[model samples]
Target: MPPEVIERDYGCGDPSKYLRAGETVLDLGSGTGKICFIAAQVVGPTGRVIGVDMTDEMLKVARTNAPVVAERIGYANVEFRKGRIQDLALDLVKLDEELQVRPITNAALFVQADGVAQKLRLKHPLVGDESVDVVVSNCVLNLVEPKSKRQLFGEIFRVLRKGGRAVISDIVSDEEVPEDLQNDPELWSGCISGALTEEGFLRSFNDAGFYGIQILKRDEKPWQTVEGIEFRSVTVEAFKGKQGPCFERNQAVIYRGPFKAIAATYAGEGNITQGGINMGSVSKVSHRALTEAFDEPLTRAQVMAIVSPFIRRATSTPA
Candidate 1:
């Protein structure tokens, strides 16, 4: 990585460690391209890494340093794009180029510009659907505006291929952040005010229809505290491809010792409890069995074998 990128980088945790070789990766809010550069090397020459950021200055620095990193690594598999994380389909760079030709200076032109943007989104999306193998972010999710956060998660889920996963590292508050704190520009810019509660952070993934959600890491010490609200760093991993039809194969899985009662989403229904007892319907039990199996001392192949029949390619359009 270039010294310029390293100096300008800001993050709470390393999501690159979770990446695998030869996988396509998307780095959200990739300021200075630090994480993208690291991910490029980790994913190797066969893999590809795309960084997206809305800031022009950050994008400029990243685009400039990209060639240097590629030269050092002897391959050019990393590129940066300009767009909002929430709306990955709209290419802001392309919009800028179009605006230079047909500038929007009046109300009528502005409305026309909106149509042009929509056309660009349809014709040339910044990130295509079901295109990436992994989506990674480092301490940047909280920077998104509160109203657009749901769309942000949906965009992450949209660009991912079936069975693809997201590894995110961000600050989470122990308690809900107060409205006053959230409204403060300084706190929000500092990545403090917009922090979601730890439970809410995980729940957001669940609500986004991601399964096998797990906390890869959580800092023991608080990163910061505001008005008795403790904020700490946490790395979360969630998988896509849980949406599909459930077929009964008369499969049964024995629950090992662990939690007395646990809830899971399966068969397009609400929580199903399993309390150290055998459960049926392999197709219905989506996350709990897979999550528990992963928590145990089982290999990736073994874990896949356990959920292979249950896993199906998602057919519905991404939210």
Candidate 2:
């Protein structure tokens, strides 16, 4: 809402556009609080918005300008906290204040600081467990240290209620970034070094126990190119509540194998003889010979179509 926030804002996507009224929303890496402010309005007077940022300057601007937005909106329902996105329970705000009064200079003091931090986490977590309705992030998750990335994703998964979802917009690489490139501090800060590959991005959500994941948007052209590698924006929507007791839904899997085929159909159909499929292999050469008539992507899609049918069926019987 403030011009200053707008000026300082840097984001790859707007995750808050999907917010609903009366929901508790958490904005991770909410630099400048632009998304948080917009989300506050979207969530309305009854809702609450919390923005977390590790940067003092960004937090300063965000906290200073939050009241302005609240006054304009006729309700104050947004707050900013100082916490690392990867470890939300650390409560950097409280740590800063505690250290000001008594800095840790010895092993005992350091242990005391750790104890205090543990207490803060248990008693007053920056974002409580299963307390948020939605977790939104705009171009920030990649900024976290690689060692802490899995934990960061886990935090996002943890803070959300059972049915909560995460709407994230961040940069993803077409291929795996090299370790050398990842080690570069400049690239790391620029959102290039720590980016995940497209597959890795989706896998992160699945590994974090999210399901029903879908790509909402993908930039066709590279946002930046380096070493012939393309880096682009991808917005993904993933849900947190799909992990429930597995009761059979009467979904029977049908298997059709060695589909009957003429010479045309014999193409890419794994070793086909005049009598049907022989015990031969469907080499890439044969596959390409049959499908090269179409474009490459379609050829791959066709191959995928053929492969998708023979999926490993669930071990269940009819009720």
Candidate 3:
């Protein structure tokens, strides 16, 4: 990483640690491309990393340092783009160039420009739909305006491929910030006022249809305290592959009692059979019945039939 990038980095945690090799990664609000550069190395030469930021200075710093990092690492797999994290489709740099050629000065021209932006979003998105294997962010989500936060999460979800995941590290509040604090310009700019409550942050991912959400890390100590509100850094991981049809496979899983009772839900709406008992949803059968049904060897055709749905579901492209 370049000294400039390190100097400008304001991240609360390292999301790159969660990334895997040979995976396409997108870094939201990737200031100075620090995380993007780190992710490029982790993902190796076969993978690609893109950094998106709305600030020209940040983009410039990131773009300038990208080649240096690539040269040092002996491969170039990272690039920086100019765009808002909440609206990943619109390339602000491209839009600016287009506007220069045809500046909007009137209401009619403004409407025309809006149409142009839409066309650009459709034809040449900065980040394409279901394109990235992973989306990672560091200390940036809290900086987005509250009104645009939903769109930000939706954009993250939109760009990720089915079965892909998002690993995000951001500041979360112990309690909701008051309107007075939220409206404070200094606090909002400092990444304090716009912080989501810890539960709200996870709920945002859930609302965006991400499953298997987990908090990878949460700081034991608050990073900042304002008006009795304790704000700390938390890293969360969430998956994006629960939008397919359910099939009845008559599968039953035993619950190793950590809890008195457990109920599980799947995208296909299946029930978990535990200890010869049906929990809920789908079909129910005793353990002996399930075992006896599959006790006989399955012919080749029967085996294919049994697994074909899973194979198709895994390979099918996301809409």
Candidate 4:
């Protein structure tokens, strides 16, 4: 879906590329069904796509476009549930008669509209634990309050089947988010106030039982700058398994044998020292190289070359 159709398209990249056919995928914080609609194409008819959004207005727009989009592609596998990402309780029934919706109680999939900051109280008449194959989120997780972010991850863990993966793209800060900046309403709505430091963000996933987390891609451009707070757009991949992340972690596995160097070598006052070197302000090195070099990026060859040697160890056991 285009940004013009729905203005809140702040995603870093399309995550549906990683989804497999015939797998059930869930989109948390799904806004206007942009990614959900796109995911429907990839998953096919046999697969399912459930889009959960808290905003009624957004859900209205999403539902309006869902039929058209699905008809255009000839599949009705995509669905939008009106509920919060953190607390999915659209199927719950209260003892009193006032708190009931006939359609929600009867539907196969029901989602509630509640803020992720609160604890989720879900009744499993609809979706259940360990039921989904993949969970995808785009540009919305950062807006969630810090206290309930863990529960949000736990909810993802609870819904995912074994070997399920989460592909998400969000805004991440390079440094700690100051309390004052975090509390700013403008920043909060703009997707910066609730931003997590890159390390802290990954740790949250690990703490919630996700393993083998790795960055698929990272953008050099800063998306939003509020009160001098800068952030990056990163697409991350994590698995709900006991094994280590597919990408390298802290472990420094040496390249057992010398192979090849594709790029021309640069020699100056300061330059990257070839294998697995992180050169940046953090490294305190000023090399006469491309701006991309200072970014510590992986060239096509370099990214492929490191696959054999890198070994990642889980920093903590799953909770």
For 1-319, candidate 2 gives per-residue lDDT tens digits of 7899999888988888878999999999998999999999999989999999999999999989988998999999999999999998889988888888879999999999888889889988888889998899999988887788899989999998876889999999999899888999999888999999999999998788775578988889899997878999989987766333334333222112334443422122333333422322222112222333322223567877876756534234334
Off by over 4 Å in 4: 1-4, 89-122, 242-319
Tens digit per residue, CA lDDT, model 3, 140-222:
99999999999999999999887788999999999999999999999987889999999999999988877667899999999
Candidate 1, residues 20-97, lDDT tens digits: the string is: 899999999999999999999999999999999999999999999999999999999999999999999999989999
Instruction: Judge candidate 1 at residue 146 and give its lDDT.
Output: 86
- RMSD of candidate 4 to the truth, in angstroms, is 15.2
How well does candidate 2 score on lDDT at residue 34? 96
Alpha-carbon deviation at 277 in model 3, angstroms: 11
Candidate 3 is scored at a TM of 0.83
Candidate 2 displacement at residue 55 in angstroms:
1.0
- Highest TM-score: give the candidate number: 3
Q: For candidate 1, report its TM-score.
A: 0.82
| Prediction-by-prediction clash tally | 0, 0, 1, 2
With candidate 2 superimposed using the best TM-score fit, by how many Å does residue 85's alpha carbon deviate from the native? 0.7
Distance from true location, Cα of 5 in model 2, Å: 0.7
